[model samples]
Target chain A: MTGLLDTLLAGLALGAVYALVALGFVIIFKASHVMNFAHGSMLLLGGYLTAVLHEHLGFAGALAAGVLATAALAGVVDRVLLQRLPQDPRAAHVATIVTIGVDILLVTDLARRIGGDLLSLGDPWGDRVRTFGPVTVPDSRLAAVAVSALVIGAVFALFRYSRWGLSLRCAAEDTEAAALQGIRLGRTRMLAWCLAGALAALAAVFLAAFPATGLERTTGQIALKAFPAAILGGLASPVGALAGSLVIGLTEAFVITYQSDLHVLGDGLSDVAPYVVMVLVLLVRPNGLFGAKGAARV
Target chain B: MSDAAKHLPRLTAAVVPLLVLCALPFYLESYWLRIGLFSMAAAIGAIGLSLLSGTAGQLSMGHAFFLAVGAYGYVWFSGDPGPGLPPVVAMVLAVLLAGAAGGLFSPVAGRVKGMYLGIATLALVFIGHHLMLTLDGVTGGFNGRSVEPMEIGGLVLDSGRDDLVVLGVPFGAEERLWYFGLVLLAFTWFTARGLLRGRPGRALAALRDSETAASVMGVPVARHRSSAFVVSSMYAGLAGVLIALSFRRVVPDHFGLVLSIDYLAMIVIGGLGSVGGAVAGAFFVTALPLVMAKYADQLPLVAAPGSPDGSLGPTEASRYLYGAAIVVILLWAPDGLHGLARRLRSRLRSRLRREPPAPPHGPGPAEPVTPAPTTTAPSVPVKEHTP
Candidate 1:
């Protein structure tokens, strides 16, 4: 019972972190209709910034700087590169491929700079744990859950009430209609990219916290796990992303916890459990759990 | 002009290149031959991907999975630990095995469309990797397995029998494999071009442009989609067999997500939906890193392999260059190298004739022009529902 509880807590904490990244994917897809493949590298960039600056700026200041810098970089990428492309439906697919190119560039440069070295981000919680009855949890895990819930709640509120959110929703619904109604599609889309970037940066902190061995170059690849999370929820749904992340998190946690019993599936089943779940899910629901079936008009 | 007279120049143009490629093994060193071999193998795989992702308008990120099936299948069929069949039979069976794997996944492949298909196929790569690692009996797990050199009747294609001489040049493994790669590449080119130009090619292209429209025109959408996938997998399998033969070893690491991405990059950089483009792109993408690594000492700002100093290495440098190349090519050219070459040739021809250059319209003097679609037609039929 205690082991199960421990696993549940760990899964919840992982899901929260994954939710942060998966939510980024949802926001970007909703606004621009382009799957952001460069997101993994962007997370790495944010983490790298925080890691390199924490020594001088302190953890809080460095984290704030990192998030803001990442947001700015995403905004610039949209304004400078993606926005310059011809505005057409086909451009969305092209933009997605372009992101793959950008990812390669970012990952290569960052990996070269990192060079097999692990750097600490100097978080407030360093190997600290708190025992709650039968279960012991890391301070960082608790912090992750609390912070993610707060941030996600605030984002939901913003989406529900903010003017930018209204414009973003309207634009995503119908680009031409929204444009006629005086919404700046470019600005709304760019803002969505910036917001997603900020979320990814925040998630990077938790990803590199206790239990993980600091920030390495391949840390970006861990962010790729969020792809299954995002896709499972449907690309356009934020709430779905949260649910999907939790499901994936729980599945991975259970698989790792019970690896000895499931030895027939081979070692390291946890690493690929999310993808397996995703494929099975997709087999049943082509558009994802929450995605609507689009009807074609002749 | 008579038809034969008109075709003479084109025939000579094609024949000249063929002669040059055939003669390369005799003149070039083993290192260059090895590079050529890898490029040829990559070209075959890239051509397969081009058919599926480029011409058929489906996106696949699991190509590496099929390639692995071929590699491991060949190793198991021919090696002592398994069936111990003849190398030629093993090679054919390996390709068929890859096709059967595709057949197993056809139901999903047929139903999934565009970007959705791409993500769905991502599952295959992870699953395939897991299977490769776990099925240690066949795949040799992490360390992988050695490949048996191909033998036809009595002629061996490995350095183990290094006694043969050809025109005063020692016919080593690289030398033998060079001709073998050329033959396979030729087969790929012939088959791929034929498929593209035939009725099936037209149907696939139509489907890519508009699935609804294609189906309305009496094209069987699901069957065609799955068949394209099967054919593409077969090509990837053949490429895998050649890759294994050349390397003399098969490892799970070589067939990873990166290899799939590399194949995608090849088709895109070459000019999607073009056979010549796939070949060119494969050569460029494969050779760039290797050539850069070879001449790292001469290149500025690139540290040698394993250098302690924290500087950009040849591998990283090459990656940056190609990554940027993909972006720049998509941005500026959009039509890729094949298109660029076509335009250049047309311009040169016009200049020689002293006639004013034809306005850059659709087709030029190129034979049987299949205009490569610039974008994949939207697979999702209607407006996305907002929740």
Candidate 2:
């Protein structure tokens, strides 16, 4: 019973981060029709940037600087690279790969500069482990869950009723059609990117406090998790991201904890476990747990 | 240089570069020699990716899977000190095995297209990595295996005579590696070119442009698609063989998702579907890192605004270079270096002959990009999804 509770708690905590990342992925994909493979890289950048700032210039300042940097970087991406793409839009294939290249360059740059041994990250809350009966949770984990829930509500509400949200939806639904109806596709996209960047930044800051792993592998691993959650949540659905993330997080935590004895493939199949879930979900429910079948693809 | 050369400009363009490459080992140092061989090994992977992504129009984010197969397949068959088989044969065996693996994995591709396929392939990479790390027998666990230097009967390739003297002129071992690379390249080059020229290439292009039309026209869409995957994997396998043989060892990390992205970058930067593009892209990507690593310390001014050293950190610089180049190439030069080269060559030739640049690139109208469409900017390593 204790193990089950611990596994569930662990799942919810990690899933919170995954869900936030997924929300970020969904926003960019929904608005721009671009998958934004660089989202993970951005998330990592946010974490590291905040850590660097926090270390150098207090917590509030670091948070402000990190958010600003992420938004600025997102805008740069939009204005410089993405803005120039042709409207016919099959170019996403190349675009996706280019993002990968950008990610490699960005992560490599981060790793080279912050060449520390242990996966160092900044957690202002300190690394304090707390327990409740047999089910123990870290201070950082609870904080992450809290932050995730808050952001999810804010983003979900903003998208539901806000005029900007309406414009974003219009742009995503049919860019040309939206343009005809007076929505500035470019502005909408840039704004979505900014919002998504900030969200990813938030995820990064919280994750840093929790995982504390260095940026190198963290970038890739975080990206990998976000992918399953984002896809599982539906490309256009933010709430789906949260739900999908929790499901994936719980699934992984459960497997990691319980299946140690399974020893199916020598080590934990847990490494590729998320991907297994992703593939299975993709096959059975191509649009994701809550994704609209017609609108979402991958 | 006749104004009216009978051959397509591609053939003429390749001739000079080919000759220049063959003689590279003579001029370049051993350090460069190593990079040259590495490029050749990478070219093998790039060519495969070029065919799959560039020509077939399918995005695979799991290209590293095929690379790992080739790297490990050779070891499985020829186990360092176990077989003493010729390196060329080892490469060929690796290629065949990888092709088989590609073929086995082809079923998922049949029913699933676009992002689904990308997801499936992405899963493969993680699975492959897990297998490599966990399986102690085949992959040599985590530390990876250190292969013996390739021996060609009398010659010990890894060490020994660093250069082969002919006509009293010393040619370095790197030069020898280039020769070896060139020979293998010739085979891959011919195979890729043959595909592009033949009915199959046309069919593949047709499938990419419109699957329904091709299927309607009696093209076995599934079969052709699967065959393309198989061929692509074989190319990757050969590339893997080259990589393993060149290093005289293979680490699972070397064939991770990053490697797949590297291969994709080559094809995209070079010009998809053009063998020349694949080769050029491979060289560009391979050489950039070597050059950057060498020059990063020398020229610190090019570092990002925040980099402490006032110069780009070598590894980071290489990645930064890779990202910037990829983004630039994709957005500004969609046609890649091959396309860019063609445009420049044609423009230059037309100016020299006074015939206006032969309509710039192709005769087709450039697609009108609207501001409304979603912009997928970032590059996802193997198994990219953009439907």
lDDT of each: 0.86, 0.73
Candidate 1 structure quality by residue, lDDT tens digits, B1-387: 999999999999999999999999888989989999999999999999888877788889899999899989999999988999999999999999999998888988887777777877878888899998999999999999999999988899998645999899989999999989999999999999999889888898888877889999999999999999999999999999999999999999999888887887787677678888889989988987788668865778877777776777787788887788778876654555765676567566655644455445534543223333333212211111000
- lDDT tens readout by residue for model 2, A240-277: 88888888898889888977676866675766788878
**Which residue pairs come into collision in candidate 1?**
none
For each predicted model, how many residue pairs clash, with residues at least 3 apart or on different chains? 0, 25
Every model: iRMSD: 4.0, 5.9
Where in model 1 is the C-alpha error above 4 Å?
A91-93, B345-387
DockQ of each: 0.51, 0.40
**Alpha-carbon deviation at B81 in model 2, angstroms:** 8.1
Candidate 1, residue B29: the lDDT equals: 87
What digit string (tens of lDDT, one per residue) describes model 1 on residues A125-162?
99999999989999999999999999999988888899
TM-score of structure candidate 2: 0.86
Top candidate when judged by TM-score against the true structure: 1
- TM-score versus the correct structure, for each prediction: 0.93, 0.86
Recovered native contacts, candidate 1: 0.48
For model 2, the docking class works out as: acceptable
